[model samples]
Target: MKQLLLEIDETTEAKINAAAKTAGLSAQQWLQQIIDEKTVTTWPNAIKALAGTWQDAPFSEELRAAEGQDISREDF
Candidate 1:
């Protein structure tokens, strides 16, 4: 694991401390959670659950057919 140092204004620091207390987490844990939520790129669970939902729709055939096919390229 790596260590990080952050500097914030007194007001912001106070807010963070209050929030961490409210959430029942140590200040370090609360900050880490906030960082993870902002930085992580994985799809949310709700969106992941929607995968393949359109497979049986009426346009599914046309949608798949258009996947890799290309159009004619014209010269300028």
Candidate 2:
């Protein structure tokens, strides 16, 4: 585990503290989780950036059909 120090405005600090309390975590723990999520290099955003220029991609009809397979009464 690494320790870090950050400075933010009172409003932002209060918001983070509130969120941490709501999720039953300490302010430090919640802030660390947020930082980890933002800094993780090999996440979904990185993968999408690497796959550049999808100009010739074909839409999969099978996927389109599968999307509508699960129907519910509320869907109507």
Q: How far is each candidate from the true structure, as Cα RMSD in Å?
A: 8.6, 13.6
What does the lDDT come to for candidate 2? 0.82
TM-score: model 1 vs. ground truth: 0.58
Query: Which ranges in model 1 have alpha carbons more than 4 Å from their true place?
Result: 51-76
Tens digits of per-residue lDDT for model 1 on 4-47? 88889999999999999999999999999999989989988999
Off by over 4 Å in 2: 43-76
TM-score of each: 0.58, 0.48
- What pairs collide in candidate 1? none
Lowest summed lDDT across 10 adjacent residues in model 2 is found at 67-76
RMSD of 2: 13.6
lDDT of 1 at 75: 95
Angstrom error of the Cα, residue 45, model 1: value is 1.8
RMSD of 1: 8.6
